[model samples]
Target: MSELCRLWHVTVTVAGEEVEPLIVRNALRRLSDQRPFLHSLKYAGGRAEIQYWEEAESLLDASSLALRVWNEHRESAGLPRWEVVGLEVLERTVFLSRGMEYHVIVDLHDVTPLPF
Candidate 1:
């Protein structure tokens, strides 16, 4: 089975009004439908503000999808300026947890044991 990881953060500002997180989330969800890799969204800082994004895959896919969605909506709606200011990768490591750090994102459907 193959595993995927995605994480990112973006900031969008309204020209003259406060933005809403729900709006951003909905927009992101719509983008996810088209991209299929975006997993979820998170909120921080304050209301009508986005602190970060937890994507299901990688920054490349997440950002690309988000940028496209934002641009499309921006051109049509003409409300807020959607901007992605930051993108980052979240890596895993074996540490004091004493367990495998990686996880399965999709079922492998394999029953054969690996030969060491």
Candidate 2:
């Protein structure tokens, strides 16, 4: 039987040498523009949090991709040369069960840039 893909919510946090806040913000905005599926982005001068959904056959596959997201987009997105400091991957159902307050309901078509 073919493995069925499942949706996994991924949150990746990266941190490195500090840079200007505007530079980080703009890079994140560019990243969001390039990857519209991103649910939300939050950043400071030295760190950032990226949230999105990944469709894969297992948590391992999903987390693997999540781990590479930053480096893969670094050049095109102009993201900082940072190290991924944290990662969280949860099945879609489990993610939602965490309650409304823990997440933001984002309309993919209308993503707004948020400040740190």
Candidate 3:
């Protein structure tokens, strides 16, 4: 089989209240918690992001889970919708950690943003 690697780095931007970002962050945390396979979300380059090892076996499933959070909170967040401008797929080998970091979202409430 092809070497499994989907070290996805997704960025989402919300178009409403400042708390909107938190909504997305929290949802992602919950998602990672539920699936245990999907890693927690992160913030980078003025966007909320995440990286996972594609343990879901299907990138589409991973992508859907990311979008699902926005759908679940669209109404209450006062957000018309969130925009996923890009899902930056990269070679897993690029990360110094060598993709050994497909970890669960630990604490979204206090995650520092990764420098762009």
Each model's total of backbone clashes: 1, 0, 0
Which is better, 1 or 3, measured by lDDT?
Answer: 3
Q: Rank the candidates by TM-score, best first.
A: 2, 3, 1
After TM-score superposition, the amount by which residue 80's alpha carbon in candidate 1 deviates from its true location, in angstroms, is 4.6
User: Local distance difference test, per candidate?
Assistant: 0.38, 0.84, 0.48
Q: Which pairs of residues collide in candidate 3?
A: none
Candidate 1 lDDT, 9-94, residue by residue in tens: 43332222445655544554444444343323333222222222445466566556544544565544332464544443332232
Which consecutive 10 residues in model 1 have the weakest lDDT in total? 105-114
Per-residue CA lDDT of candidate 3, range 24-66, in tens? 5555555455545444456543355544444233556556665
Candidate 1's displacement at residue 63, Å, is 8.3
The residue-by-residue lDDT of candidate 2 on 1-116, one tens digit each, is 24699988888989999988889888988899888888778888889888888999999999999999899999999999999999999898988888742546555423344465
Number of the top TM-score candidate? 2
The TM-score values for the models, in the order shown, are: 0.35, 0.86, 0.43
Ranking by lDDT: 2, 3, 1
